[model samples]
Target: MNIDLRVIGEAFHQFLINIGLTSGQASLIDWIFGALILLVIFIVLAILLIWFERKLAGRVQDRLGPNRVGPFGLIQPIADTLKLFTKEDITPAGADRITFNLAPTLAVFSIVMAFAVIPFADKVIGTDINVGVVYLMAFASVSSMSLLMAGWASNNKYALLGGFRVVAQLMSYEIPMAFAMLLPVLLAGTMRMNGLVEAQGQFFGLGWNIWIMPAAFIIYLTTALAEGERAPFDLLEAESEIVAGYNIEYSGLKFAWFYLAFFMNTWVLSAVATTLFLGGWQGPFVSQVPALGVVYFLGKTIIMFVIFAWIRATFPRLRIDQMMSFCWKVLVPMVLVLFLLTAIILKLGLPTIAVWLLILLSNVAVFVIALWLLGKGLEKSKWASKRLFTPEIPRL
Candidate 1:
């Protein structure tokens, strides 16, 4: 019958019906089945990502990493998981035991909730909410609060400072991130994640939003990194700075939860990018064989993950002040301008290609202008260097 929207889910419902279940019961059962499947897939990916990151880091740094565990160190994640499980759970003597323990769990849980809206294939989303895009952003904001919990609960000055840093960072970046996402919403006229993908449909299976809104794509990627706590945005984990930041006092499995959440956030960020810009499950042959959609989605996600790892390997961390300044002084203004530009273009009722060209031009101009300003600022900073000139004596 109607397998066009969500074939896998529809097939599962049929299977349940064959077993003599009523429609309502089968629908409920199918949802549970999908949820469980999504959970298992998330865990498997988290394990693989941990291993991949370590191996990538080792190669980048010219050292062997996790060579002794499994084939090509493939079982390294399993070993690490066991290690964390076996370690002592140390709660600081001065810590608030309840919040200390609960924060990590909440950290992990908040991100896991995002797995529900991601569509692995058409109709295969975990109960596609009407406002899937908004849901993801809201949940992402909620996860940051968990960092505050961890930092304050530890009762250490460093932990408290790290919490403040996270709040400040999240606050600074969230605006640009949300505004950046609205570009796609502006074009698609819907906040549904699936709708965003479908709206990108064009001649020759190339309706991805990235081509239409390249500036938004770049901004989204940058803000996504900040949101996910990836380097060079990983101020939360600055060991020499804040003493390992919010999770400083965490150890053992509780710490493991925070650790997993960090990487899991990375995965979610990449997946969301894939969905919004790269056309989540939209690809050749996807219409004929729906399972292929999952392949395309995963492939794009892996590529995004590699870029994340490359940044981690290549760039040094930014100072907290620098990070905050970049977000506010730079990204915020750029995205705000982008928002008005998007509204004006849509209001003008231009041809799709014309709209695409105008936006692309604006994005290029913004990029060039941003670089020029940054470079000029760098030159000014060079002139202001205390080493380059005598330090002005303070008039006491």
Candidate 2:
């Protein structure tokens, strides 16, 4: 049960060379194989995610979900995919044909590219590039362009409005998200994904960044909810408001691409959050048995994903203005403050325990203050005023 993945990988690479391939060609094949493995793993996970969400939503609403498709509806996503394949592919008559055709591909592609830098386990990264964090940020921004293309190219008013919202929402949220991301890099002193994970591995994996920088972790998840366009913050595709938003005109497999990309992006965000704050692949015995690291990583990621699903199921969507205000007025300033505090604390040359204790107390203090301020702001809002002070009409 304990497989040495590094040895297997090396053996495969040598086998490719033995089959009359040049060293360069063999290396390219090795990379392609790695990419394919990642793709296959994600595609399978995407199917299960769709099913899990459906079941979760159904149970939340007191109903059985997709029981007719297969045993526990395991085959439902496959059936759905086939149905989408059979549906007619239509391009709106006035659409810019090229951009419309390319947008969905770009959306999915950008998310997939983000996986290139993530470490699933020890020695399990795709490419341990020095600028992996920057690489992830760059590709994530591409989704904005893809959204704009889909909306504008379709020549539809609703799509155009959704596109406008994407620019405003994603760009604004990225400010806080970027600042939140920088906290881990600042603490770890490296931008590599593996480095970030390794930095949290001290003291038998009990030294997670989440313990010392809880505020940043919360800020990152909040901004991630906005960045992924998940529920509550999902103004970009407010179905009641924008009629399915930017991808309204897409049909069949094209629409499926957008849908798949949304869920995949959710997984990616959860995985990144896990790696950064959860001491990814750092469980007891992981160093002794490397394969267990993969299991630990996946378990943590799934827990994070469940948090996302629970929030989606329970919280109502925010109005567009409220979402933007929360990011700029709340998360951005809080992250900036924490970032400054961290820098000053690091420069103080404190002992390890003292540094962690001070940072932990700072995070807790900031979190409580932010919540108190947010509650005060809510109490002052018109809705709260009306609800608290307005006379209730007698029910007939």
The most accurate candidate by lDDT is 2
lDDT of 2 by residue, 1-396 (tens): 567668888999999989999999999989999999888887999999999988988888789988988899989999999999999999999999999999999999999899888888988988889998888889888988899999999999999999889778999999998888898899899999999999998887668988879999999999889888898898888989998899999999999999998888988999989988998888988877999988999999999998898888888888887787888888988998898988998889999878888888888988999999999999887646654766789999
lDDT of 1: 0.86
Q: Candidate 1 lDDT, tens digit per residue, 337-374?
A: 88887788778888877887888788778777877887
Which residue pairs does candidate 1 place in steric collision?
Answer: 200-207
Task: Give the C-alpha miss distance for residue 178 in model 2, angstroms.
Answer: 1.0
Error of 2 at 183 (Å): 0.5
Q: What overall lDDT goes with each candidate model?
A: 0.86, 0.89
Candidate 1 backbone clash number: 1
Among these predicted structures, which one has the highest TM-score? Answer: 2
